[model samples]
Target: MPIVEINFDGLIGPSHNYAGLSFGNLAAMKNAGAVSQPRAAALQGIAKMRSNIALGLTQGMFLPHPRPNRAWLTQLSTDVDSASSELLANAMSASPMWAANAATVSPAPDTADGRCHLTVANLRTMPHRSHEWPNTLAQLRLAFGNEQHFAVHGPVPPAFGDEGAANHMRLTPSHEAPGLEVFVYGVAGGAFPARQHVEAFRAIARVHRLNPERTLFAAQSEEAIAAGAFHNDVVAVANGPVLFAHEQAFADKAALLDTCTRLVPGFEYVEVPAAEVPLTDAISSYLFNGQLVTLPGGEMALIVPSEARETASVWAWLQRHLAGNGAIRRVEVVDVRQSMANGGGPACLRLRVACDPATVDPRFLVDDAKLDRMAEVVASHWPEEIAVADLGRSSLIEAVESARAQMLDLLDLTQLASG
Candidate 1:
C-alpha cells in the first residue's frame, strides 16, 4: 500500500508548431510563426524522461491528441475540404504539449472517499486551448477508467474556467500521507486574463471531498500574472515539505506560508527574494517553474531548463540555492528549448500523480523499451520543421496524421486516434 509520485509527461505531438496562439505566454507570442521541429521536440522530451528513468524515477507519458484537431474545426463549421481560412489557425495548436494543464489529480490520500480523483481542465479562457478538454477527457477515461481506485470527473462547468494542475499544488509529508491541497487562483490581474477561477478551484476541492481544514486557496499575485506567470506553477512549485516560490509569487505570501506551516508538519518555505531576482527575470528564465522532484536517495533535485542556467540572475540564484544545501541538494539542467520556445518548461510538460502503480492504468506507464520505440517513431516519421504557412497544406496534414497514427500503434493506444 505504499504510494509514489509518478510524472506523466506529454509526448510532443507531430503537429507541434509556433502559432503564437497563447495570449499570456510571452515566448509563444515572441516565437510565433517560427519554424518548429516536431521530431527534435519529441526526441528531447523522450530523452528527458529516459534520463529520469535512469535516475530511478517513475515516469509515464500521455500521447498528443491528433491534429489539426478535427473536433474543433467542425465546431467552427469548417471542413477539411474548405479549411483554408486563418480563422481555423488556432485549431492547429499543439498546446496539449503542456500536460500540466491536462487535468487536476487528487491522490487517494487526499480524497474523502479514499479514491483518487481527476478532473480535466476546461481551458475555456483561451480560444486556441478551449477545445482540448474533450480529447483530454477521452485519454483520461481510457487510461484511468479502472473505477475501483480512480474516479475521473468531467471538466468543470465552462462558466468557470479551470486550468487544472497548473494552478493546483499538493503538500504531503510523504507520498502515502494525506496532506494539505493548495488551490491558487487569481482575482485582480492586469491585461492578461486570470485562467484559474476561484469558483472552479472551490468546486474541484469540494467535488473531491478534500477535508476543508486541509485545503487552502491562495491568490496569485497580480504582478506575477501581469509578468506572464499565467499559471501558479510558473511562480511556485511544491514537493513534499518544501514549497519553492518567489517572494512575490502570491498575494499575502507570508500568511499563506504561515498557514502551511501550521497545517503540515516539517513544512519548509524556500523563497527567492524579489530584490535578488526580479519578476521579469523569473518569468523570462522560468527559474521558479523548474520541477522540484524528490530523488531516490531521500534528497530533492531541481530539474530546470537550460535557460535558467544561462540567465545570469537565475544562475546566481540557483548556485546560491545549491550552496545553501537545504531541501534541494541537486540541480540538473535539461535542454527543452523546443518546448521553451512555446512558453513551457520542464514543469509545464508534466502532471504529477501520487499513487500505487498497480492501481493505475498500465497503458500509460513508460519503461525503457517503450521509450526506445517511441524515439524511433519520432526520428522516422516526425517532421523536422513546420512553418505557419504550411499548417494548412495537405502534405503537412498527411504527415502529421501518419506520424501520430504510427505513435498510437507503437504505444498500443490506437483507440485514441481519430477514425
Candidate 2:
C-alpha cells in the first residue's frame, strides 16, 4: 500500500465575517467587527489549493457547511425565519471555513485494521462551533463512505473537548510505513481555557486502535496556551519525518525530541529557538502554522502566510533556515488574510489525509479543470463582503443559500444542496 499525504482544504463559505466569536484566539479578537471579503476569501482559498496542485501535490476540496444554520437556530427555540438573540448569533458563525479542525484522520498505515480512519471533531470549546459536528459528519460520510478502505467515525462525547488535527500529529519514516501518532493536550493556562482535553485524545486513540507502543502523548506548554497558541498546530507541525516547531511548543520539548529520535532513527526536529523568535511573535505571525510539505522533487517546502513574511523575526528565521543544508529547501507565501483575520492560516485551512488518491471520491479531488469551475461559481455568486451588522439582513441569508446551492450544483453534488 503506497500512501501519499493529500491536503484537503475547505472552500471558504459565503458568510465569513469577523465577529470575534472565538474566546481565546488573539487574531479573531483583534479583528472582530471588521468587514470581511467573502468572495476574495473563497477565491484566495481556492488559489492556495491550486498552487499546491500545481506543485504536483495531491489536493482535495471539501464544501463548506451551510450557514445561517437553520437546524442550529431551531435547536435554540427559534426558527431561521424569525431567529433572534443567541439563536441568530450562532447562525452567523463562519467557523466551518477552518477545515483542519474538521476531523482527525489516521491513515491506513497507522491504523490496526489497515483502513484509513477519520473522526470528526466535536469542537466543544467554542459555542459558535459546537453545532457543526452533525453537518460535518454528513459531509465526511459522503466523501469517505468507501467502506473497504475508509472508516469515518462520529465525534467523541463533548464531556471532553476535541479540536481534531489541531491537537494531533503523525510522524512516519515514510507515508507508506507504519508510523507514530502524537496527541497533544493542555491543562489550564492564563485566562484562556485549554481546548484539547487529554481524556479526549486518549479516547480517540483507543477508538482508532492505534498501537499503544507507537502512540505518544505530549503536553502543550501553558506558556504557549496563554500566549494565544490555542492549538498545538499553532506552535508545531509534523510531516513525514520532520517536526517544525517553536521551542516552547511542548511541556517537555527535549524529552519529546529524544523520544521521537529513539522511536524513529533519522527523525528531524526543526525547533525555532525562543531566544530568536519570541512566543508572542510566533503566535502573531503564525510562524509554526505554515504548511510543511514535500514537493514533487522530494525536496521539502514551507507554504506560509504573507503575515509571516511581513514579521521581521519570522522572515529572518526562514531565510537562515532555508539557506542552510536542511530538509526544508523552499518557502512559498500565500495570501489568506481573510482567514488569517479569523485566526486561521495555511495549516488551519486544511485536513491532511494520507492514502492512495485513487481510493478517494473523485468528486472531492482537485485539478485545474475543477479549480476553474469552482472559481466560476465563487466569482458569480459569493458575496463581495459581509459585516457583523449584516447578519440580520434577509438579503445576506438569501445570498449565502443561493451561493451554496450554485456551488453544489456546479460540482454535480446536488444531493448535498439544501432543500
In candidate 1, residue 369 scores what lDDT?
Answer: 94
The lDDT per prediction is 0.89, 0.89
Please give the distance, in angstroms, between residue 47's alpha carbon in candidate 2 and its true position after superposition. Answer: 0.7
Stretches > 4 Å off in candidate 2 = none
Summarize candidate 1's per-residue lDDT along 374-399 as a digit string, tens digits. 99999999999999988888898889
lDDT string for model 2 (1-419, tens) is: 56788999999998888888898999999998899999999999999999998888999988877788887777777876687645665777878878889998898887899999999999998989998888888888888889999999999999999999988999878888888899999997689989999999898898888999889999999999999999999999998889999998899988888879988656999989999999999999988888999987888899999999999999999899988877789999999999999999999999999988888888888898999999999999999998887787889989998999999988888877652
TM-scores for every candidate against the unseen true structure: 0.98, 0.98
User: For all the candidates, what are their Cα RMSDs to the real structure?
Assistant: 1.1, 1.1
In TM-score terms, candidate 1 sits at: 0.98
